[model samples]
Target: MSGLETEKELAEEFVLAAFEKDDRRTIRRMLTSDALVYTPNVPGPGLDVDEFESQILDAFHGAFPDLSIAVESLVSEGATVVCRFTMTGTHEGVFRGIEPSGETVLVTGVVELRLTGSGIADVWQTTDSLALLEQIAAYDHENVRGERGS
Candidate 1:
């Protein structure tokens, strides 16, 4: 296979290991020790591998115990692969400071992964947080309208 094809395959494996299998060890092995992750929901410059595994992966699993990711597509060029995926789960635990509503949520997201010979080096990810919140009834539309009128 070509290099791009190899990279795409790696990206697929990464996604399967991380989200489908929920294998933290495989994820850690796939990432460089100092891998940097960038996400809108996270504050600061970026997150290292450890932080990404804990704050994002672990916390998300805690919030949505039965969460599953369905990969819609993957595109690769050079050493970078972009994956589009859909996440579905029931909100059973607190997430982003919002209490659980036991509502099902479906959110779409994209993640770009930059790979090195050793492992994945950098990641940039974004998800539809507003849609997730809406699905969970976290936003009060009436209150927002009243505040707007005020």
Candidate 2:
């Protein structure tokens, strides 16, 4: 396999270990020490890979223990792999400040994983954050109605 293919495999293993296996340490060991997580929802310039794993990995995995991500498609070039995939899970724990609503959320996103000699160099990604918030019963529908003076 080429560098891109190997990187893609590593990325898949990381995701599987995260969502399917719920092994945070396995995924943690796979990330670069200087990795950055740029998510709109999280309040930070960026979260280090380890912090990202600690803060999110288990909460999401605990909430959606059966969470699974499928790589719907991919485009590989050299050491870069751009993956398009869907993430499906159920709300079995609190996400953000909201309590679990026992809702199932299936969100889609694209991630570009760049690989180095050691492992993944960096990952740039985004997903439907609003949709996910809504799915988790985080959005205040009553507030919207309240604003409308219902």
User: Which ten-residue region of model 2 has the weakest summed lDDT?
Assistant: 35-44
Estimated TM-score per prediction?
0.89, 0.80
* Top-scoring candidate (lDDT): 1
Estimate candidate 2's alpha-carbon lDDT, on a 0 to 1 scale.
0.74
lDDT, each prediction:
0.86, 0.74
Q: What is the lDDT of residue 61 in candidate 1?
A: 81
lDDT of 1 at 56: 85
Q: Please tell me which predicted candidate would have the highest TM-score against the true structure.
A: 1
lDDT of 2 at 142: 72
Q: Write the per-residue lDDT of candidate 2 for residues 1-150, one digit (tens) a residue.
A: 776676677777766675567776786677777877665656777778776676667567767776878878777788777878799988887776678788889998777777777776677667787778878874776788799995
